[model samples]
Target: MDETEELIALCARALVAQMGDVPGVEMALTRNGVLGLTGAPSPDFNRLTLGAGPQAEDFLISSVGRARARGLPLVVVMSPQAQAALAPVAAGLGLTVAGTSPLMVLRPETPVTPSRPVKITRALGVELVAIAGDLEAAAFDEPRDAIARYFDVCLTETAGVEAWIAWDGDLPISAVTVTPTGDTAGISLMATPPEHQRKGWGRALLTQVMADYRSRGVARFHLGSTEAGLRLYESVGFVTVANLSAWLLPAEGALPGRDRGGPS
Candidate 1:
């Protein structure tokens, strides 16, 4: 695999590891794919990651069966190359295209100063889990309870995940998570509520996280970005490495709530 492909794989593995222990979630690793099963009623927790190879289609088919048997929605994450190779196969299976995001990576570079005064601090213990849910609810405009369920399962002590929140005075405005896998640190869930946009909170939060990770000897970082977040990430020296497509099997009856689908 090339540099971009390698980074994508590393990020995918880190995500799976972070979410692997959700109470009812089961993760199965195949030779060319990884499947996450959230045995609960919510479809938002289930995920699949496709690796590069001809077995991509077969792996996806098997994942669909597993998800269906448990009555959960299947969200498939695949790189541009893998998506191209599986397009015809996915078409035949009648899967719906949910959304797509650009995968970005940042190698060690000169640090950029934040335009605003923002203080970022790590969230420890249960505070970390609560902050994660709260940030997602505020950023996505969803119910806090629904988002909390995800954090409750995914943010344990052994999950190898760390969360940080950006504060303006005593109020928290932005949040992000960093997970280390091999030599690469995957940065994800960078979020700021609609009311706080354009104030440099996102940039400040990311700059702090990047600096902290770099201090720990981590030189590489990866994340998938939405259209609204693309500019902020680019401002911090992140470049597009690949485009990732998420194919969703919409659940019955309007689907519980809106899922950001890809990484934030």
Candidate 2:
């Protein structure tokens, strides 16, 4: 694949590793894109990230239908590369633009480090993994149960994915996840709770993680950045590759067949 396509594929692979086996989740690989449904209340977990290809429209429509069938909201993540080909199709399917983020790739350089280093460690055991999930949920204002469930599966079983957390003595301060695909690695779900936002923990954890991964020979890194995170990422040498537009399909009020992590 070419450079842009390779970055997109890294995103797809990282997403699949995190969501593939989260109990009530379902995933489908289209001709060039990926569809994921977590059956969670949050739209963040239900997505269709399109790729640049002839079948992009078909994959989008079918993915929307799948979400509607389950009575859930769906978010379609489209990069500028795919928007020319799929935006009209998404509009025809009744998806409305919800938000936009930047898709970024790290430049070839040492990651930026915080002036004062903080203790950061890989989330190795079940308890630490669960703590990582808790921090993520708080950071993003997502449902705790659903986020926790995804991280539990991701930390316990996903081979390519790994999580790290910054700590203050015995308490956790920030968390992030990384998934390596060949020389490229995808950074995701970086979190620092509201109370801890101003501290340098996030920068510390991010730089340390990237540097450690670099030591392991991972030459490139990519991530989708919220407006709040753009500066932080750019400070560490990540350049915007594409503008990612998010389109949302409101829920139809149909209940999911099974709600994972909730009373059955």
Candidate 3:
């Protein structure tokens, strides 16, 4: 793969590793220019697919149709370029497209060093914590041991499997995971408890991860975000680079049977 494609692939794999525990999510290859989105995605989280020829509009319409037919949301996650080419059809479908989380890529040229140094020491007993049991009961609300096991498989099976629950003392507040892809690093499984809002813990965990990536010579760091989380990401130096969106059709929509797809 060329540089761009390679970067996309690295990002995709990192995503897969992060969400691998979410039973509904999976990674599937896409046609040139497109990729699949997997992992318990809402109908709004359809595949970050590529485009076809001049008929790209028609193709998107068809993909949207099939997703809604399965009682699944047809979410199209795409880069800025892909989103631009397919906007006409996307807007017609009541799609909501937003920027990927602003990511501060640690390029040698990326300016503005962090205000303070990050303290990343050991993985054992430390200021970090983790809960490995099935999170569906609380986090996902689906409540099934099997569902929780999904994450276990992903975390244990992968090479870069580290989950963190940052704490000021004994109480748990924020959480984040770091995964690697090629020469870059990916951040996944980020969460902060409701009571922990506005506390700097979330940014602290994220900054710590980014610093680690910098030390490793990672060319880029990647993230996806919702409108609510945009400001938080911006503070760390991420930009408006790509977007993923999809249409929400009623049952028996156009093309029936297209699986929830996009990413790799």
Candidate 4:
């Protein structure tokens, strides 16, 4: 694979690891795709990542079958090229197009310096996990329990993932996660409560995380960006490298919710 392809695959693996350890969740790599099964209400957690190739269509078909068998909503992550190749097959399977997200990367020649002195602390213990989960849920307008599950999974593990919360005078305002894959670190779950937006807390949190990872000898960073935060990430030296599309298959008698905002 080329550098871009390698980076994308690395990011995908990182995400899989982040989703690991959740109760009733399982992940497997097959010739078809990278499959994640979460027999829960969160559709975002149940995903399939498809690569571009002649087998892409077959992979999509099998992935859909796997999701259907589990009776969960299916989110398919595919490169733009792969999406094009499998569009007909996806459509034939009744998969609805769920918007596209840009995959961005940052390769810094020097360690990133924080824009301001933000009191960022590593999230430890169950209490802090609940706080971080609340911050995330408030920021994304999601259910607290759902966001808490993510924190519960990541914080319980030492390898592959790390979580941090930005505090303003002991008041947690933002949260971030870094998952390392090979030489690249994937950033996700970045969220600042609505009351804290436009005040630079998000940037400060991200800067600190970048600096922390850089100190660990990680130079490359990858994230999936939404339109709202694209400019903020660009200000910090991130650039769009590729696009990722998600095709959704909702469970019977259920409608898929709109994609959540912020970096994934």
Candidate 5:
């Protein structure tokens, strides 16, 4: 409703467009392998949908019904107006709702202006490897070949949100992506393997991710995070700047997948 909220909404819409076209885990198709307009084909569980829209209203109702009927956690994000309209629809279907409003965390030009006390330094071996279609592995139960081919279709259609694998050894444990938003970077789909978490994998990965972007003169960092991630980002020098939350959860509800690192 305010200026900041408007900015968040704009950023989220941009990300949805970017991620939806990619049709990766976060933007996967359903289990039935239904041919989405994108033709990338994801599991029904990994549906990529628009926020509540006039054209998408009936489709959202159907999605909410499907989620309730199947007991799967169906995720939908949209504008505030669309969210409000879908409220009754969600409630009508007995679906639990939550929303992790998107927020912008700005980095000051002079982050090191005033020197602090002893800085907490840790040994973090971080590298940003750019791959055209690195890890398109099946997020659900599909075979690797099928998922990769499907993802390739999405990658071809998308102009933003290229994949980046964060690796420690030969194996990639953590992964996150950035979708271009004009001059800004909208970070999305961050994940770490279950066995690899709590070892600062996410922290280290995010640190390097931002550092890489900053070096390129990327101004504002845009992202939508769960509540748990708020604290994590704050520790990494991110400030609460805007709200792009949808009706995925309650206003005070926790963000999703703060604990589960890999492939949500």
Candidate 6:
């Protein structure tokens, strides 16, 4: 992989490292570029990402079998480069394409200037993280505790991530997380409640966060975005670098071809 793609993969690795830190979560990093995280509160957390590698097919089968053994719903994620070959393989294993997300990146030289002035705060303690989690859950319409379980891990100082929140007085209004990996930083879990949409709070929060990181001598930032979030990310000078394909198993039971053991 080239430098930009390698940076993207590093961000992903950093993210899974954070997920693995949460109490009982199990993580597997395979030599063939498959990453599995199981036993989290949601299937999204229990994901297996397939990166570009020569033994990807065999690696994927083994990874899925492991998740099956754990009896957890699994979501498989693949980069654009990996999807063309793996999509059919994923289907044969009883998985179907769920959605696609754009991988976006921003270099330090690009300016991120929010249209309005706003105050933002860093989440310090467990209480603040929980509050930020609540805001995130509300924004995404996900179960609060499921999201909080992951957010809480950000409190670990060496986890390479920092959580930030924007408040409306006592109410936590917006939340974002930045994971700094060497010279590049990955932005994730940015949220603002539906009621507060179009108010430019997202812009303000993102700008401030990027500015803070840039001041610290980190220039590059990257993230994956849903279609709904594309415009907002684009407004902040982020451009799409890749489209990641995601697949999910039919249900939480046995995988289709598990009996036909795969090559490790």
- Say which prediction, candidate 1 or candidate 4, comes out ahead on TM-score: 4
lDDT (10s digit) by residue, model 6, range 53-161: 7877887887777777655668887876668878778888778888888888897778766566667888877788777888888898887766766667655667767
Q: Any runs in candidate 6 off by more than 4 Å, and if so which?
A: 31-34, 255-264
Where in model 4 is the C-alpha error above 4 Å?
253-264
Candidates in order, TM-scores: namely 0.87, 0.91, 0.64, 0.89, 0.55, 0.89
Find the 10 residues in a row with the least total lDDT in model 3.
Answer: 121-130
Highest TM-score: give the candidate number. Answer: 2
Evaluate candidate 3 by giving its C-alpha RMSD to the native, one decimal.
Answer: 6.0
* Cα lDDT listed for each candidate: 0.73, 0.80, 0.51, 0.77, 0.47, 0.74
lDDT of 1 at 21: 64
Q: How high is the lDDT of residue 15 in model 2? A: 79
Question: Which residue pairs clash in candidate 6?
Answer: none
Q: In terms of lDDT, which candidate is strongest?
A: 2
lDDT of 3 by residue, 163-207 (tens): 655556655556666676656666655666556668676787677
Candidate 4's displacement at residue 5, Å, is 1.8
- Model 1's number of clashes is 0
> Model 1 reaches what TM-score against the true structure?
0.87
Ranking under lDDT, best-scoring first?
A: 2, 4, 6, 1, 3, 5
Off by over 4 Å in 5: 1-5, 12-74, 78-86, 89-95, 99-104, 107-158, 241-264
Q: Mind giving the per-residue lDDT tens digits that candidate 5 earns over 1-264?
A: 553544444455544554454332332232211112222222322342344335445666555444333333444554455556666775665445455465646554524111222122211222222222333242223455543443333343244555455565556666666665655676755655456667776677666666666778776676666675677667666676644334331212223433221232
Mark the regions of model 3 whose C-alpha exceeds 4 Å error after superposition. 1-10, 18-27, 31-41, 44-69, 89-106, 111-152, 157-162, 242-264
Q: Give the total clashing residue pairs for model 3.
A: 24
Candidate 2, residue 139: lDDT: 95
Higher-lDDT candidate among 3 and 4?
4
